[model samples]
Target chain A: MRHHLILRVVTKLLIGSIMLFALYVQFHGDYSPGGGFQAGVIMAVAFIIYGIVFSLQDVQRVLPPWLVHKLSALGVLVYAGTGVVSFFTGYGFLDYAALSPHHPVHGQHYGIILVELGVGITVTGVMITIYYAFTSRTPVMDDEAW
Target chain B: MLRTRSLFATVMLAGVFSLLSALLFVTLDAVDVAFTEAAVGAGISTVLMLGTLALTRRFESPPAHTPVIPLFVVLVTGAALVYGTLDMPYFGSATAPAQTHVAPDYISRTPHEIDVPNIVTAILASYRGYDTLGETAVVFTAAVGVLLLLSGLRRRRRKEEEDV
Candidate 1:
Protein backbone atom coordinates (compact mmCIF):
# COMPACT_ATOMS: atom_id res chain seq x y z
CA MET A 1 0.00 0.00 0.00
CA ARG A 2 2.86 2.36 0.79
CA HIS A 3 4.22 2.12 -2.73
CA HIS A 4 0.86 1.97 -4.44
CA LEU A 5 0.61 5.36 -6.13
CA ILE A 6 -3.05 5.08 -7.21
CA LEU A 7 -4.13 4.02 -3.75
CA ARG A 8 -2.38 6.96 -2.09
CA VAL A 9 -3.75 9.50 -4.58
CA VAL A 10 -7.32 8.19 -4.36
CA THR A 11 -7.23 8.12 -0.57
CA LYS A 12 -6.19 11.78 -0.39
CA LEU A 13 -9.16 12.71 -2.56
CA LEU A 14 -11.65 10.44 -0.77
CA ILE A 15 -10.93 11.23 2.89
CA GLY A 16 -12.01 14.89 2.78
CA SER A 17 -15.20 14.11 0.86
CA ILE A 18 -16.13 11.29 3.23
CA MET A 19 -15.63 13.60 6.21
CA LEU A 20 -17.82 16.28 4.60
CA PHE A 21 -20.57 13.74 3.97
CA ALA A 22 -20.36 12.61 7.58
CA LEU A 23 -20.87 16.19 8.78
CA TYR A 24 -23.83 16.59 6.47
CA VAL A 25 -25.40 13.41 7.83
CA GLN A 26 -24.82 14.64 11.38
CA PHE A 27 -26.37 18.11 11.01
CA HIS A 28 -29.11 17.35 8.50
CA GLY A 29 -30.35 14.39 10.54
CA ASP A 30 -33.30 16.31 11.98
CA TYR A 31 -34.84 16.88 8.56
CA SER A 32 -33.48 13.78 6.84
CA PRO A 33 -32.95 10.10 7.64
CA GLY A 34 -29.51 9.96 9.28
CA GLY A 35 -28.47 10.99 12.80
CA GLY A 36 -25.54 10.77 15.22
CA PHE A 37 -24.94 7.03 14.96
CA GLN A 38 -24.85 7.04 11.18
CA ALA A 39 -22.71 10.16 11.03
CA GLY A 40 -20.25 8.74 13.56
CA VAL A 41 -19.85 5.53 11.62
CA ILE A 42 -19.35 7.47 8.40
CA MET A 43 -16.69 9.59 10.09
CA ALA A 44 -14.98 6.51 11.46
CA VAL A 45 -14.97 5.00 7.99
CA ALA A 46 -13.06 8.01 6.69
CA PHE A 47 -10.37 7.56 9.33
CA ILE A 48 -10.25 3.81 8.93
CA ILE A 49 -9.84 4.11 5.18
CA TYR A 50 -6.99 6.54 5.74
CA GLY A 51 -5.36 4.07 8.10
CA ILE A 52 -5.76 1.29 5.58
CA VAL A 53 -4.18 3.25 2.74
CA PHE A 54 -1.39 4.82 4.73
CA SER A 55 -0.05 3.49 8.02
CA LEU A 56 -1.72 3.18 11.43
CA GLN A 57 0.85 5.61 12.85
CA ASP A 58 -0.17 8.29 10.36
CA VAL A 59 -3.79 8.10 11.42
CA GLN A 60 -2.69 8.17 15.08
CA ARG A 61 -0.74 11.34 14.42
CA VAL A 62 -3.88 13.04 13.09
CA LEU A 63 -5.95 11.80 16.06
CA PRO A 64 -3.89 10.82 19.09
CA PRO A 65 -5.08 8.02 21.39
CA TRP A 66 -5.37 10.35 24.41
CA LEU A 67 -7.62 12.74 22.50
CA VAL A 68 -9.71 9.85 21.28
CA HIS A 69 -10.12 8.54 24.84
CA LYS A 70 -11.09 12.01 26.14
CA LEU A 71 -13.58 12.60 23.31
CA SER A 72 -15.31 9.30 24.10
CA ALA A 73 -15.88 10.33 27.74
CA LEU A 74 -16.70 13.96 26.91
CA GLY A 75 -19.65 12.95 24.74
CA VAL A 76 -21.28 11.05 27.60
CA LEU A 77 -20.60 14.02 29.90
CA VAL A 78 -22.26 16.44 27.51
CA TYR A 79 -25.32 14.19 27.36
CA ALA A 80 -25.60 13.72 31.16
CA GLY A 81 -24.70 17.37 31.80
CA THR A 82 -27.67 18.49 29.71
CA GLY A 83 -29.96 16.61 32.04
CA VAL A 84 -28.22 18.02 35.14
CA VAL A 85 -28.67 21.60 33.91
CA SER A 86 -32.39 21.06 33.35
CA PHE A 87 -32.68 19.54 36.84
CA PHE A 88 -31.05 22.57 38.45
CA THR A 89 -33.41 24.91 36.63
CA GLY A 90 -36.44 23.47 38.48
CA TYR A 91 -37.32 21.05 35.74
CA GLY A 92 -37.25 17.28 35.69
CA PHE A 93 -34.27 15.47 34.20
CA LEU A 94 -33.79 16.07 30.44
CA ASP A 95 -36.56 18.66 30.40
CA TYR A 96 -35.77 20.80 27.39
CA ALA A 97 -38.40 23.40 28.27
CA ALA A 98 -36.05 24.90 30.84
CA LEU A 99 -33.52 25.78 28.16
CA SER A 100 -35.62 28.59 26.73
CA PRO A 101 -38.24 29.98 29.07
CA HIS A 102 -39.86 32.19 26.43
CA HIS A 103 -40.07 29.62 23.65
CA PRO A 104 -40.32 26.02 24.75
CA VAL A 105 -40.10 24.89 21.15
CA HIS A 106 -36.72 26.54 20.72
CA GLY A 107 -35.56 24.78 23.88
CA GLN A 108 -36.68 21.48 22.41
CA HIS A 109 -34.64 22.16 19.30
CA TYR A 110 -31.61 23.09 21.38
CA GLY A 111 -31.96 19.99 23.53
CA ILE A 112 -32.23 17.68 20.53
CA ILE A 113 -29.17 19.23 18.91
CA LEU A 114 -27.14 18.85 22.11
CA VAL A 115 -28.22 15.26 22.65
CA GLU A 116 -27.52 14.36 19.04
CA LEU A 117 -24.14 16.06 19.24
CA GLY A 118 -23.29 14.01 22.28
CA VAL A 119 -24.34 10.85 20.51
CA GLY A 120 -22.28 11.78 17.45
CA ILE A 121 -19.16 12.64 19.42
CA THR A 122 -19.25 9.50 21.54
CA VAL A 123 -19.94 7.30 18.53
CA THR A 124 -17.09 8.78 16.49
CA GLY A 125 -14.65 8.51 19.38
CA VAL A 126 -15.55 4.96 20.33
CA MET A 127 -15.68 3.67 16.76
CA ILE A 128 -12.26 5.10 15.96
CA THR A 129 -10.88 3.80 19.26
CA ILE A 130 -12.06 0.29 18.48
CA TYR A 131 -10.44 0.42 15.05
CA TYR A 132 -7.22 1.70 16.59
CA ALA A 133 -7.24 -0.95 19.29
CA PHE A 134 -7.52 -3.76 16.76
CA THR A 135 -5.01 -2.38 14.24
CA SER A 136 -2.39 -1.33 16.79
CA ARG A 137 -2.06 -4.69 18.54
CA THR A 138 -1.68 -6.80 15.38
CA PRO A 139 1.82 -7.47 14.14
CA VAL A 140 2.67 -5.96 10.81
CA MET A 141 2.75 -8.29 7.83
CA ASP A 142 4.23 -7.95 4.38
CA ASP A 143 2.00 -6.84 1.54
CA GLU A 144 2.35 -10.22 -0.11
CA ALA A 145 1.08 -11.96 3.03
CA TRP A 146 -2.14 -9.97 2.96
CA MET B 1 -19.76 -24.10 3.23
CA LEU B 2 -18.87 -21.79 6.14
CA ARG B 3 -18.01 -24.80 8.30
CA THR B 4 -15.24 -25.84 5.93
CA ARG B 5 -14.15 -22.36 4.86
CA SER B 6 -11.12 -20.33 5.96
CA LEU B 7 -11.65 -17.58 8.53
CA PHE B 8 -11.18 -14.84 5.91
CA ALA B 9 -13.80 -16.43 3.66
CA THR B 10 -16.18 -16.83 6.59
CA VAL B 11 -15.70 -13.19 7.53
CA MET B 12 -16.39 -12.13 3.95
CA LEU B 13 -19.56 -14.19 3.94
CA ALA B 14 -20.67 -12.52 7.17
CA GLY B 15 -20.03 -9.08 5.69
CA VAL B 16 -22.12 -10.00 2.68
CA PHE B 17 -24.88 -11.17 4.96
CA SER B 18 -24.83 -7.83 6.77
CA LEU B 19 -24.97 -5.86 3.55
CA LEU B 20 -27.91 -7.97 2.38
CA SER B 21 -29.70 -7.41 5.69
CA ALA B 22 -29.03 -3.68 5.40
CA LEU B 23 -30.67 -3.73 1.99
CA LEU B 24 -33.56 -5.60 3.57
CA PHE B 25 -33.91 -2.89 6.19
CA VAL B 26 -33.99 -0.22 3.49
CA THR B 27 -36.77 -2.07 1.68
CA LEU B 28 -38.58 -2.40 5.00
CA ASP B 29 -38.59 1.44 5.31
CA ALA B 30 -36.09 1.47 8.16
CA VAL B 31 -33.41 3.76 6.78
CA ASP B 32 -31.74 4.47 10.11
CA VAL B 33 -31.51 0.82 11.03
CA ALA B 34 -30.16 0.05 7.56
CA PHE B 35 -27.52 2.73 8.01
CA THR B 36 -26.43 1.19 11.33
CA GLU B 37 -26.33 -2.41 10.11
CA ALA B 38 -24.41 -1.49 6.97
CA ALA B 39 -21.88 0.64 8.81
CA VAL B 40 -21.37 -1.42 11.95
CA GLY B 41 -22.00 -4.94 10.68
CA ALA B 42 -20.65 -4.74 7.16
CA GLY B 43 -18.01 -2.02 7.42
CA ILE B 44 -16.49 -1.87 10.90
CA SER B 45 -16.88 -5.49 11.97
CA THR B 46 -15.37 -6.75 8.71
CA VAL B 47 -12.33 -4.52 9.15
CA LEU B 48 -11.99 -5.57 12.79
CA MET B 49 -12.12 -9.23 11.82
CA LEU B 50 -9.34 -8.69 9.27
CA GLY B 51 -7.16 -7.06 11.92
CA THR B 52 -7.85 -9.97 14.25
CA LEU B 53 -6.86 -12.36 11.50
CA ALA B 54 -3.60 -10.48 11.11
CA LEU B 55 -2.82 -11.10 14.78
CA THR B 56 -3.64 -14.81 14.81
CA ARG B 57 -4.03 -17.90 12.63
CA ARG B 58 -6.14 -17.56 9.48
CA PHE B 59 -7.51 -21.12 9.65
CA GLU B 60 -9.70 -22.39 12.43
CA SER B 61 -8.72 -25.55 14.33
CA PRO B 62 -11.01 -28.55 14.31
CA PRO B 63 -13.66 -28.58 17.01
CA ALA B 64 -12.61 -30.44 20.16
CA HIS B 65 -16.13 -31.25 21.39
CA THR B 66 -19.38 -32.65 19.97
CA PRO B 67 -21.82 -30.15 18.28
CA VAL B 68 -24.94 -32.11 19.31
CA ILE B 69 -25.99 -30.12 22.42
CA PRO B 70 -25.31 -26.75 20.79
CA LEU B 71 -27.19 -27.84 17.68
CA PHE B 72 -30.15 -28.92 19.77
CA VAL B 73 -30.21 -25.62 21.66
CA VAL B 74 -30.09 -23.62 18.43
CA LEU B 75 -32.88 -25.68 16.88
CA VAL B 76 -35.08 -25.18 19.95
CA THR B 77 -34.41 -21.44 19.98
CA GLY B 78 -35.14 -21.14 16.28
CA ALA B 79 -38.39 -23.10 16.64
CA ALA B 80 -39.51 -20.95 19.57
CA LEU B 81 -38.73 -17.72 17.68
CA VAL B 82 -40.63 -18.91 14.59
CA TYR B 83 -43.59 -19.97 16.73
CA GLY B 84 -43.63 -16.61 18.51
CA THR B 85 -43.59 -14.66 15.24
CA LEU B 86 -46.69 -16.59 14.06
CA ASP B 87 -48.70 -14.85 16.82
CA MET B 88 -47.32 -11.37 16.01
CA PRO B 89 -48.78 -8.75 13.69
CA TYR B 90 -47.84 -8.54 10.04
CA PHE B 91 -44.96 -6.25 9.05
CA GLY B 92 -45.92 -2.56 8.62
CA SER B 93 -49.64 -3.33 8.95
CA ALA B 94 -51.76 -0.21 9.62
CA THR B 95 -53.94 -1.80 12.33
CA ALA B 96 -51.13 -3.43 14.25
CA PRO B 97 -51.01 -3.27 18.03
CA ALA B 98 -47.93 -1.00 17.90
CA GLN B 99 -49.78 1.57 15.78
CA THR B 100 -52.81 1.38 18.11
CA HIS B 101 -50.93 1.85 21.36
CA VAL B 102 -49.44 5.08 22.84
CA ALA B 103 -47.89 5.59 19.40
CA PRO B 104 -50.99 7.65 18.57
CA ASP B 105 -50.26 10.05 21.44
CA TYR B 106 -46.62 10.44 20.38
CA ILE B 107 -47.63 11.14 16.80
CA SER B 108 -50.38 13.65 17.65
CA ARG B 109 -48.58 15.55 20.41
CA THR B 110 -45.05 15.50 18.98
CA PRO B 111 -45.75 18.48 16.73
CA HIS B 112 -46.97 20.66 19.58
CA GLU B 113 -44.92 19.25 22.43
CA ILE B 114 -41.52 18.64 20.82
CA ASP B 115 -42.11 20.88 17.79
CA VAL B 116 -40.06 18.61 15.60
CA PRO B 117 -41.00 17.41 12.13
CA ASN B 118 -38.93 14.28 12.51
CA ILE B 119 -40.91 12.41 15.09
CA VAL B 120 -38.25 9.71 15.40
CA THR B 121 -35.63 12.24 16.43
CA ALA B 122 -38.04 13.88 18.85
CA ILE B 123 -38.87 10.57 20.47
CA LEU B 124 -35.23 9.43 20.69
CA ALA B 125 -33.64 12.69 21.83
CA SER B 126 -36.47 14.22 23.88
CA TYR B 127 -39.10 11.68 24.87
CA ARG B 128 -36.65 8.83 25.41
CA GLY B 129 -33.57 10.90 26.22
CA TYR B 130 -32.62 8.75 29.21
CA ASP B 131 -32.72 5.59 27.12
CA THR B 132 -30.45 7.13 24.47
CA LEU B 133 -28.12 8.34 27.21
CA GLY B 134 -27.91 4.81 28.56
CA GLU B 135 -27.17 3.47 25.07
CA THR B 136 -24.38 6.03 24.64
CA ALA B 137 -22.88 4.91 27.96
CA VAL B 138 -22.97 1.30 26.77
CA VAL B 139 -21.02 2.27 23.63
CA PHE B 140 -18.50 4.11 25.78
CA THR B 141 -18.06 1.01 27.96
CA ALA B 142 -17.40 -1.13 24.85
CA ALA B 143 -14.57 1.23 23.84
CA VAL B 144 -13.13 1.03 27.36
CA GLY B 145 -13.23 -2.76 27.27
CA VAL B 146 -11.37 -2.96 23.93
CA LEU B 147 -8.76 -0.46 25.11
CA LEU B 148 -8.12 -2.48 28.26
CA LEU B 149 -7.67 -5.65 26.23
CA LEU B 150 -5.28 -4.07 23.73
CA SER B 151 -3.24 -2.12 26.30
CA GLY B 152 -1.80 -5.48 27.37
CA LEU B 153 0.12 -5.52 24.03
CA ARG B 154 2.22 -2.56 25.22
CA ARG B 155 3.12 -4.40 28.41
CA ARG B 156 4.08 -7.52 26.45
CA ARG B 157 6.35 -5.44 24.21
CA ARG B 158 8.09 -4.01 27.26
CA LYS B 159 8.63 -7.54 28.66
CA GLU B 160 10.18 -8.70 25.37
CA GLU B 161 12.50 -5.67 25.39
CA GLU B 162 13.55 -6.46 28.98
CA ASP B 163 14.28 -10.08 27.99
CA VAL B 164 16.42 -8.90 25.06
Candidate 2:
Protein backbone atom coordinates (compact mmCIF):
# COMPACT_ATOMS: atom_id res chain seq x y z
CA MET A 1 0.00 0.00 0.00
CA ARG A 2 2.80 2.38 0.90
CA HIS A 3 4.58 1.62 -2.34
CA HIS A 4 1.39 2.21 -4.34
CA LEU A 5 0.82 5.52 -2.61
CA ILE A 6 4.36 6.63 -3.26
CA LEU A 7 4.08 5.66 -6.90
CA ARG A 8 0.82 7.58 -7.18
CA VAL A 9 2.29 10.72 -5.66
CA VAL A 10 5.42 10.56 -7.75
CA THR A 11 3.45 9.98 -10.94
CA LYS A 12 1.15 12.90 -10.17
CA LEU A 13 4.10 15.20 -9.59
CA LEU A 14 5.76 14.06 -12.78
CA ILE A 15 2.56 14.48 -14.77
CA GLY A 16 1.95 17.92 -13.33
CA SER A 17 5.46 19.08 -14.06
CA ILE A 18 5.33 17.76 -17.62
CA MET A 19 1.99 19.51 -18.21
CA LEU A 20 3.32 22.81 -16.93
CA PHE A 21 6.41 22.41 -19.01
CA ALA A 22 4.30 21.55 -22.06
CA LEU A 23 2.39 24.80 -21.78
CA TYR A 24 5.59 26.71 -21.37
CA VAL A 25 6.99 25.01 -24.44
CA GLN A 26 3.90 25.71 -26.51
CA PHE A 27 3.74 29.42 -25.83
CA HIS A 28 7.47 29.97 -25.82
CA GLY A 29 8.39 27.60 -28.62
CA ASP A 30 9.43 30.41 -30.95
CA TYR A 31 12.37 31.19 -28.69
CA SER A 32 12.81 28.00 -26.69
CA PRO A 33 14.20 24.48 -26.79
CA GLY A 34 10.73 22.89 -26.96
CA GLY A 35 7.66 22.97 -29.15
CA GLY A 36 4.52 21.11 -30.19
CA PHE A 37 6.05 17.64 -30.54
CA GLN A 38 7.80 17.85 -27.19
CA ALA A 39 4.73 19.19 -25.46
CA GLY A 40 2.56 16.50 -27.07
CA VAL A 41 4.88 13.72 -25.95
CA ILE A 42 5.05 15.15 -22.46
CA MET A 43 1.28 15.33 -22.23
CA ALA A 44 0.99 11.74 -23.49
CA VAL A 45 3.59 10.61 -20.97
CA ALA A 46 1.53 12.14 -18.16
CA PHE A 47 -1.56 10.17 -19.12
CA ILE A 48 0.43 7.00 -19.63
CA ILE A 49 1.84 7.48 -16.15
CA TYR A 50 -1.70 7.94 -14.84
CA GLY A 51 -2.72 4.71 -16.55
CA ILE A 52 0.21 2.93 -14.94
CA VAL A 53 -0.62 4.00 -11.38
CA PHE A 54 -4.37 3.83 -11.54
CA SER A 55 -6.18 1.11 -13.46
CA LEU A 56 -6.57 1.51 -17.23
CA GLN A 57 -10.31 1.58 -16.62
CA ASP A 58 -9.89 4.50 -14.25
CA VAL A 59 -7.81 6.33 -16.79
CA GLN A 60 -10.42 5.59 -19.43
CA ARG A 61 -13.04 7.07 -17.12
CA VAL A 62 -11.15 10.33 -17.05
CA LEU A 63 -10.56 10.19 -20.83
CA PRO A 64 -13.14 7.87 -22.32
CA PRO A 65 -12.15 5.78 -25.33
CA TRP A 66 -14.83 7.30 -27.54
CA LEU A 67 -13.71 10.80 -26.63
CA VAL A 68 -10.13 9.92 -27.42
CA HIS A 69 -11.18 8.60 -30.82
CA LYS A 70 -13.14 11.75 -31.52
CA LEU A 71 -10.29 13.95 -30.37
CA SER A 72 -7.91 12.12 -32.67
CA ALA A 73 -10.14 12.72 -35.66
CA LEU A 74 -10.87 16.25 -34.50
CA GLY A 75 -7.15 17.04 -34.37
CA VAL A 76 -6.65 16.04 -38.00
CA LEU A 77 -9.69 18.07 -38.93
CA VAL A 78 -8.30 21.07 -37.13
CA TYR A 79 -5.01 20.83 -38.99
CA ALA A 80 -6.50 20.13 -42.40
CA GLY A 81 -9.23 22.70 -41.91
CA THR A 82 -6.66 25.38 -41.25
CA GLY A 83 -4.93 24.54 -44.49
CA VAL A 84 -8.17 24.34 -46.40
CA VAL A 85 -9.21 27.67 -44.96
CA SER A 86 -6.03 29.18 -46.32
CA PHE A 87 -6.78 27.68 -49.71
CA PHE A 88 -10.27 29.17 -49.76
CA THR A 89 -8.83 32.51 -48.80
CA GLY A 90 -7.01 32.54 -52.20
CA TYR A 91 -3.71 31.24 -50.82
CA GLY A 92 -2.01 27.99 -51.70
CA PHE A 93 -2.57 25.05 -49.39
CA LEU A 94 -0.92 25.76 -46.01
CA ASP A 95 0.06 29.19 -47.32
CA TYR A 96 -0.05 31.30 -44.18
CA ALA A 97 1.03 34.43 -46.06
CA ALA A 98 -2.35 34.69 -47.69
CA LEU A 99 -4.17 34.10 -44.39
CA SER A 100 -3.78 37.79 -43.63
CA PRO A 101 -2.45 39.69 -46.59
CA HIS A 102 -2.31 42.86 -44.50
CA HIS A 103 0.08 41.32 -41.95
CA PRO A 104 1.51 38.10 -43.35
CA VAL A 105 3.85 37.42 -40.42
CA HIS A 106 0.99 37.59 -37.92
CA GLY A 107 -1.02 35.25 -40.13
CA GLN A 108 1.90 32.86 -40.31
CA HIS A 109 2.25 32.85 -36.52
CA TYR A 110 -1.46 32.33 -36.05
CA GLY A 111 -1.55 29.49 -38.58
CA ILE A 112 1.47 27.81 -37.05
CA ILE A 113 -0.04 27.96 -33.58
CA LEU A 114 -3.29 26.47 -34.83
CA VAL A 115 -1.46 23.66 -36.57
CA GLU A 116 0.77 22.99 -33.57
CA LEU A 117 -2.26 22.74 -31.32
CA GLY A 118 -3.69 20.20 -33.74
CA VAL A 119 -0.50 18.18 -33.66
CA GLY A 120 -0.47 18.25 -29.87
CA ILE A 121 -4.08 17.14 -29.61
CA THR A 122 -3.74 14.29 -32.09
CA VAL A 123 -0.44 13.07 -30.63
CA THR A 124 -1.76 12.99 -27.09
CA GLY A 125 -5.06 11.38 -28.03
CA VAL A 126 -3.58 8.69 -30.23
CA MET A 127 -0.84 7.83 -27.74
CA ILE A 128 -3.31 7.39 -24.91
CA THR A 129 -5.58 5.38 -27.17
CA ILE A 130 -2.70 3.08 -28.07
CA TYR A 131 -1.92 2.58 -24.40
CA TYR A 132 -5.56 1.84 -23.65
CA ALA A 133 -5.81 -0.72 -26.44
CA PHE A 134 -2.65 -2.49 -25.34
CA THR A 135 -3.70 -2.64 -21.70
CA SER A 136 -7.27 -3.82 -22.38
CA ARG A 137 -7.99 -7.47 -21.57
CA THR A 138 -8.66 -9.88 -24.40
CA PRO A 139 -12.35 -10.54 -25.03
CA VAL A 140 -11.85 -14.30 -25.29
CA MET A 141 -11.04 -14.44 -21.59
CA ASP A 142 -14.51 -13.07 -20.83
CA ASP A 143 -16.25 -16.23 -22.13
CA GLU A 144 -17.12 -18.93 -19.58
CA ALA A 145 -15.13 -22.10 -20.14
CA TRP A 146 -17.26 -25.17 -20.92
CA MET B 1 19.66 -13.18 -6.18
CA LEU B 2 22.38 -13.38 -8.82
CA ARG B 3 19.80 -13.08 -11.64
CA THR B 4 18.25 -9.98 -10.05
CA ARG B 5 21.69 -8.40 -9.80
CA SER B 6 22.30 -9.09 -13.50
CA LEU B 7 18.92 -7.69 -14.49
CA PHE B 8 19.63 -4.52 -12.56
CA ALA B 9 23.01 -4.23 -14.23
CA THR B 10 21.46 -4.67 -17.68
CA VAL B 11 18.85 -2.01 -17.04
CA MET B 12 21.49 0.40 -15.76
CA LEU B 13 23.62 -0.21 -18.82
CA ALA B 14 20.70 0.44 -21.17
CA GLY B 15 19.87 3.62 -19.29
CA VAL B 16 23.42 4.87 -19.53
CA PHE B 17 23.64 4.14 -23.26
CA SER B 18 20.34 5.87 -23.93
CA LEU B 19 21.45 8.92 -21.93
CA LEU B 20 24.70 9.07 -23.84
CA SER B 21 22.90 8.87 -27.19
CA ALA B 22 20.54 11.68 -26.09
CA LEU B 23 23.52 13.81 -25.07
CA LEU B 24 25.14 13.16 -28.42
CA PHE B 25 21.97 14.25 -30.23
CA VAL B 26 21.82 17.44 -28.14
CA THR B 27 25.47 18.22 -28.79
CA LEU B 28 24.74 17.93 -32.51
CA ASP B 29 22.04 20.63 -32.10
CA ALA B 30 19.24 18.24 -32.97
CA VAL B 31 17.25 19.45 -30.00
CA ASP B 32 13.92 18.05 -31.18
CA VAL B 33 15.42 14.67 -31.95
CA ALA B 34 17.29 14.71 -28.67
CA PHE B 35 14.16 15.52 -26.68
CA THR B 36 12.27 12.63 -28.33
CA GLU B 37 15.14 10.16 -27.89
CA ALA B 38 15.63 11.14 -24.27
CA ALA B 39 11.95 11.00 -23.41
CA VAL B 40 10.94 7.91 -25.38
CA GLY B 41 14.11 5.85 -25.57
CA ALA B 42 15.59 6.54 -22.17
CA GLY B 43 12.43 7.29 -20.22
CA ILE B 44 9.41 5.46 -21.60
CA SER B 45 10.98 2.48 -23.36
CA THR B 46 12.86 1.35 -20.28
CA VAL B 47 9.83 1.82 -18.05
CA LEU B 48 7.52 -0.05 -20.42
CA MET B 49 9.96 -2.93 -20.92
CA LEU B 50 10.44 -3.19 -17.16
CA GLY B 51 6.68 -3.09 -16.61
CA THR B 52 6.21 -5.90 -19.15
CA LEU B 53 8.78 -7.95 -17.31
CA ALA B 54 6.91 -7.33 -14.08
CA LEU B 55 3.66 -8.53 -15.64
CA THR B 56 5.33 -11.57 -17.19
CA ARG B 57 8.31 -13.69 -16.19
CA ARG B 58 11.78 -12.21 -16.01
CA PHE B 59 13.47 -15.22 -17.54
CA GLU B 60 12.81 -17.75 -20.28
CA SER B 61 14.36 -21.12 -21.06
CA PRO B 62 17.34 -20.97 -23.37
CA PRO B 63 16.76 -22.22 -26.90
CA ALA B 64 17.50 -25.93 -27.23
CA HIS B 65 19.42 -25.40 -30.46
CA THR B 66 21.00 -22.05 -31.16
CA PRO B 67 21.39 -21.02 -34.83
CA VAL B 68 25.11 -20.32 -34.57
CA ILE B 69 25.79 -19.59 -38.28
CA PRO B 70 22.84 -17.24 -38.64
CA LEU B 71 23.82 -15.47 -35.42
CA PHE B 72 27.41 -15.15 -36.57
CA VAL B 73 26.36 -13.67 -39.96
CA VAL B 74 24.08 -11.16 -38.26
CA LEU B 75 26.81 -10.14 -35.83
CA VAL B 76 29.30 -9.74 -38.65
CA THR B 77 26.91 -7.58 -40.65
CA GLY B 78 26.18 -5.44 -37.58
CA ALA B 79 29.91 -5.09 -36.91
CA ALA B 80 30.53 -4.07 -40.52
CA LEU B 81 27.88 -1.37 -40.24
CA VAL B 82 29.50 -0.05 -37.05
CA TYR B 83 32.92 -0.18 -38.67
CA GLY B 84 31.56 1.75 -41.67
CA THR B 85 30.71 4.59 -39.29
CA LEU B 86 34.44 5.31 -39.02
CA ASP B 87 34.36 6.76 -42.56
CA MET B 88 31.53 9.14 -41.66
CA PRO B 89 32.03 12.76 -40.74
CA TYR B 90 32.77 13.53 -37.11
CA PHE B 91 29.62 14.07 -35.08
CA GLY B 92 28.37 17.68 -35.01
CA SER B 93 30.73 18.85 -37.73
CA ALA B 94 29.17 21.87 -39.44
CA THR B 95 30.66 20.98 -42.83
CA ALA B 96 28.92 17.61 -42.81
CA PRO B 97 26.66 16.97 -45.83
CA ALA B 98 23.62 17.27 -43.57
CA GLN B 99 24.50 20.86 -42.70
CA THR B 100 25.87 21.94 -46.06
CA HIS B 101 22.96 20.94 -48.24
CA VAL B 102 19.46 22.55 -48.18
CA ALA B 103 19.94 23.42 -44.47
CA PRO B 104 21.29 26.84 -45.38
CA ASP B 105 18.30 27.41 -47.67
CA TYR B 106 15.96 26.38 -44.88
CA ILE B 107 17.70 28.63 -42.37
CA SER B 108 17.86 31.63 -44.66
CA ARG B 109 14.53 31.40 -46.48
CA THR B 110 12.40 30.38 -43.49
CA PRO B 111 12.35 33.85 -41.96
CA HIS B 112 11.58 35.58 -45.26
CA GLU B 113 9.02 33.00 -46.40
CA ILE B 114 7.27 31.79 -43.25
CA ASP B 115 8.71 34.37 -40.86
CA VAL B 116 9.35 31.74 -38.20
CA PRO B 117 12.67 31.63 -36.39
CA ASN B 118 12.31 27.90 -35.81
CA ILE B 119 13.24 26.55 -39.19
CA VAL B 120 12.34 23.02 -38.19
CA THR B 121 8.74 24.03 -37.55
CA ALA B 122 8.58 26.00 -40.79
CA ILE B 123 9.94 23.08 -42.76
CA LEU B 124 7.68 20.54 -41.08
CA ALA B 125 4.48 22.50 -41.47
CA SER B 126 5.05 24.67 -44.54
CA TYR B 127 7.91 23.52 -46.75
CA ARG B 128 7.19 19.84 -46.27
CA GLY B 129 3.52 19.96 -45.42
CA TYR B 130 2.66 17.02 -47.69
CA ASP B 131 5.18 14.81 -45.91
CA THR B 132 3.62 15.81 -42.61
CA LEU B 133 0.25 14.89 -44.03
CA GLY B 134 1.59 11.48 -45.00
CA GLU B 135 2.94 10.95 -41.49
CA THR B 136 -0.43 11.91 -40.01
CA ALA B 137 -2.15 9.49 -42.39
CA VAL B 138 0.21 6.72 -41.31
CA VAL B 139 -0.70 7.35 -37.68
CA PHE B 140 -4.38 7.37 -38.54
CA THR B 141 -3.99 4.07 -40.39
CA ALA B 142 -2.29 2.47 -37.37
CA ALA B 143 -5.13 3.66 -35.12
CA VAL B 144 -7.67 2.22 -37.55
CA GLY B 145 -5.84 -1.11 -37.53
CA VAL B 146 -5.98 -1.25 -33.73
CA LEU B 147 -9.66 -0.35 -33.72
CA LEU B 148 -10.43 -3.00 -36.30
CA LEU B 149 -8.57 -5.66 -34.35
CA LEU B 150 -10.37 -4.75 -31.12
CA SER B 151 -13.76 -4.52 -32.82
CA GLY B 152 -13.29 -8.01 -34.22
CA LEU B 153 -12.94 -9.32 -30.70
CA ARG B 154 -16.03 -7.37 -29.70
CA ARG B 155 -17.96 -9.02 -32.58
CA ARG B 156 -16.86 -12.47 -31.38
CA ARG B 157 -18.12 -11.69 -27.89
CA ARG B 158 -21.47 -10.58 -29.30
CA LYS B 159 -21.80 -13.82 -31.27
CA GLU B 160 -21.01 -15.87 -28.18
CA GLU B 161 -23.65 -13.94 -26.19
CA GLU B 162 -26.27 -14.62 -28.89
CA ASP B 163 -25.51 -18.33 -28.90
CA VAL B 164 -25.84 -18.48 -25.09
Best by DockQ: 1
Error of 1 at B122 (Å): 0.9
Instruction: State in Å the error of residue A110, model 2.
Output: 1.5
**Regions of model 2 farther than 4 Å from truth:** A1-3, A138-146, B1-16, B47-57, B92-94, B150-164
Model 1 gets an lDDT of 0.89
Clash count per candidate: 0, 0
Model 2 chain A worst lDDT window (10 residues):
A137-146
Worst 10 residues of 1 chain A by lDDT: A137-146
Clashing pairs in 2: none
Tens digits of per-residue lDDT, candidate 2, A47-66, equal 87887777676788888888
Q: How does model 1 do on interface RMSD, in angstroms? A: 1.1
- How much lDDT does each candidate structure score? 0.89, 0.73
> RMSD for each model, in Å, please?
2.4, 5.0
